[model samples]
Target: MPRTDAGVELAGVSVRYGSAKQPVTVLDSVDLRVGAGEFVVLVGPSGCGKTTLLRVIAGFARPDSGSALVGGAAPRPGRGAGVVFQQPRLFPWRTVGGNLGFALARHGVPRSQRPGRIAELLERVGLPGMAGRRTWELSGGQQQRVALARALAAEPGLLLMDEPFSALDALTRERLQEEVRSLAGRLGTTVVFVTHSVEEAVLLGSRVLVMAAGPGRVVEDLPVPLPRDPGTGVPELRASPEFARLRGHLTEALRPA
Candidate 1:
């Protein structure tokens, strides 16, 4: 199993784009700490640096100022976390198993052990026996599932998702949301998800961090106490009064001031 003790810490982290003389700050002195095995969500309107903060945690982009750490060390690209992006971004030339095999190879798994690992990962993501299917042959939801399975191939301690289900149909989105929440709990993996929907944030996050635009900073850090055990269905949770209250609070927080 992947290490479940990896947490995140950010202190005074900032990012800027464009020339120094005419810089556009994207994140301003953001301070955050995500505990191990916690599901944290980032939600806000456009231009609020949600993606930027995700990138920082993934080590894809360095902070212009301050510090960002994952598992108590500076994050390095492809090091300690798995990332799922808005698009599936699978290799068109590779079959479902081929794609997952690539990830396993990168993680230094032996070739002899790869087939079993690939099967296990596919099963975990609800894609059992899909190793033979071509990437183009699968539906959008299947493609995304493959993308997710690929990310989990190495069983990284931390998973970062940037609006991963935004393009899916409503039913598919909801299903995937439940799968992710349940999977994270079962595996004890730390998750940091980014979404524009307040409902999604409340549904999946143990802690929701509401961000604001204009140099992008967190304005509200709220805990969600809803039950997320395997037996708790999404529909039941969504209809609960506590869910309604948390959703309303996050929605109100995003409104323009």
Candidate 2:
């Protein structure tokens, strides 16, 4: 059931692409509700419209039909919602600090405040002194941290992520996931994350929404009762009875009969 206090709500949402002559449905009627300050992960097989749902929440794409709300208002593109996509998507020409400052500037943050905000954000994401460094000079993980800082600078109510860690190595991926979990908790920011990895979902999300293939739709939405910490690694989690229970549950829900 959809609740007003939910950080985000998607009711009977659907998205379609392609020309009218050859229309294609990417997402079927999708009903999802992410509570305030809740971490919700959307997981499904590739091309299951996981990203499409995130975009809708971020207001990047208008659903062909149905309701999509962020923080109680209609989805508004590039506003109120901050997004971190798969790639860092930083401007190659700008230094790390400058990239974040630009984001603040766009939101009308004063010039005097931009520097402090940039520094504080960088420090929060563990990239404290790399402000002047070009984005390309940093490692993949570092670049993603910068991206997180930029997104947070906007002080968005909802942070939408689309496979933000898919490109990192296994170790780096795990490390970033822990950081993200901690950061989101600290900021009390709501997040709607999209990922193909179940381990990542359980580790970072309070609730995991599993989608089925083709014209993707939510098949299962389950709460993750584990502690949100990096100490919960894939191997350690897999060994735990709870992890096995969740894995088996989601696996069965995601599989097509």
Candidate 3:
């Protein structure tokens, strides 16, 4: 039974596209449940349908069979789940504040409070006083930070991210990963993040689910076996023995089965 306390749940969930006669299954019989405040990372090789699983939970894709639910029921689009894509996806015409304000407004935040909320969100994402900056003026990493802030501005119970930091440079990617991990912990935000990097998964996830290819199904779901170092701790985390072990296991799991 899916737990009532689970923030996100999927039971025997599968998805397919195209005509029925020649249907292609992207996700296959995936069973998962994430409790509130848990950061769950989904990692797999290319074409493993990692992003598709996220889409299902984000209410953007219907499963061909079984169920996907957020907060104990089917998620409603733009409601229970906040989604962040591979690209920043911020409107070029909108200022950083405008982008976040749009999400807050859509979520019924008062117009009078939007400015303070936008500032708070920008500060949360490490972009203090940056609301006036246009999207184009920010770096790739900065734009992605804005995207993250916009998603959080909705105050969704769950956040679904599809490789949001993949396009960034290695250093920037590391910075944002730590930022997200710490911020999620601070805000008690439940996150489902997709990534190809084993180190990233180990570093960010409370539990990491490794999926298989073809009709994607989870091959391994392992709890990250390290104490979270909340302050300036990722470097120490990456150097730890548990990190090495999990990274090795995940790397092996991603190989052809």
Compute each candidate's TM-score over C-alphas. Answer: 0.99, 0.92, 0.96
Give candidate 2 misplaced runs (Cα > 4 Å). 1-6, 229-239
Worst 10 residues of 3 by lDDT: 1-10
For residues 227-248, write the lDDT of model 2, one tens digit per residue.
Answer: 6654555566657888878878
lDDT of each structure? Answer: 0.95, 0.85, 0.87
- Give candidate 3 misplaced runs (Cα > 4 Å): 1-6
Candidate 2's TM-score reads: 0.92
Candidate 3 lDDT over 138-201, as tens digits, reads 9999999999988888777688899999899999998998899888877787889999888899
Model 3 TM-score on a 0 to 1 scale: 0.96
Q: Give the TM-score of candidate 1.
A: 0.99
Model 3, residue 154: distance off in Å is 1.6
Per-candidate clashes come to 0, 0, 0
Highest-lDDT candidate: 1
lDDT of 1 by residue, 76-150 (tens): 999999999999999999999999999999999999999999999999999899999999999899999999998
Q: Pick the candidate with the highest TM-score.
A: 1
